[model samples]
Target: MRQIQAIALVLILGGLGYALWVLYSQPPLQLSAGQADHVSTQTAPLAPVKAATDVTLSAINTLPAPTTTADAPDLTPVSRLPEVNDEETYIPPISPSVAAPAYHGDLSDHQAYLVHQSAQITQLKQDYIAAVDKKVARLESLLEKGIRHQLPAEQLQEARDKIQGLRAMQAQLRHELAQ
Candidate 1:
């Protein structure tokens, strides 16, 4: 029991010594000499100067006075003027109007033209779709009969070129129709 008590006292003394060493031996937070001087100068207040006074009224009254004029031009109203007709005025023709087309009764001629163009566009679309279907069918038939491989390379390239040309033409027609 005495040995254990002695060991406990030694540990307590060691811990207290370590605590004191840590408290005193560590370096303190520090600022440079220039920084310390800057802080002190910044905290100081400036000296006050003498306040200014208002100008005297007698100094302003001694200046030159402006002259008044009585010979200013008169602004009298003018008399009413007579109305004048100008020859340059444009007047539309009142008689002998040209007759419009029979198909363009109340509807505008442009609108009729647009409707006709729309019908033509529809027909073109149908024709293009039919042509595309025919080409697709021909391609499928050639594929099924295995004749695509049997044909010469040049002939096969030409067939592909023809289909591509037809597609391009169809696209151009569609673009025109859209416009």
Candidate 2:
């Protein structure tokens, strides 16, 4: 075993030494700046690189150039805006045809009604969760007793039905609460 290990260690050391010698034997890469780029696309598949100052971009290439204030066009006087010669002649604009709520009273009332409904929904959800907990406890106790000894079929079926009903109610209540 020692001989085999010694042979492996010698071979590994020799290989590493050979690799190091070969690495240092080669000349360093010499890049003459002129020959680095010769405008020949066939030599490399990479896109041609350009110096920052070498590229020129016009404003219209991607988006239109912004117009000066002097080049602005006059707007057509189609809107019947009231010209105010007197300071106190201003009147607020109103449209009566649209039956929008004129004030925030209706919105506030709707918000309050929703809040009250949500409180009731929360109460119902808690009640249903409690009912499910009771059913689960009852079912667990029935199962444990059935497992330990023989239980009546009618009693087991009753427990299962109770659990199913409780689960359904719980699921419905959860859905309502999520909404």
Q: Pick the candidate with the highest TM-score.
A: 2
Pairs that collide, model 1: none
For each candidate in turn, give its C-alpha RMSD to the true structure in angstroms: 34.3, 28.9
Query: Which segments of candidate 2 are over 4 A away from where they belong?
Result: 1-114
Q: Clashes in each model (backbone N, CA, C under 3 Å)? A: 0, 0
Error of 2 at 110 (Å): 7.5
Score residue 130 of candidate 1 by CA lDDT.
66
Q: Model 1, 120: alpha-carbon shift in Å?
A: 1.9
Residue-level lDDT of model 1, residues 46-90, one tens digit each, is 555445454333656546565445554554546655344465233
Badly placed stretches (over 4 Å) of model 1 are 1-114, 143-149, 177-179
Q: Local distance difference test, per candidate?
A: 0.68, 0.73
> Residue 131 of candidate 2: its Cα lDDT?
72
Each candidate's TM vs. the true structure? 0.30, 0.33
- Residue 77, candidate 2: C-alpha displacement in angstroms: 99
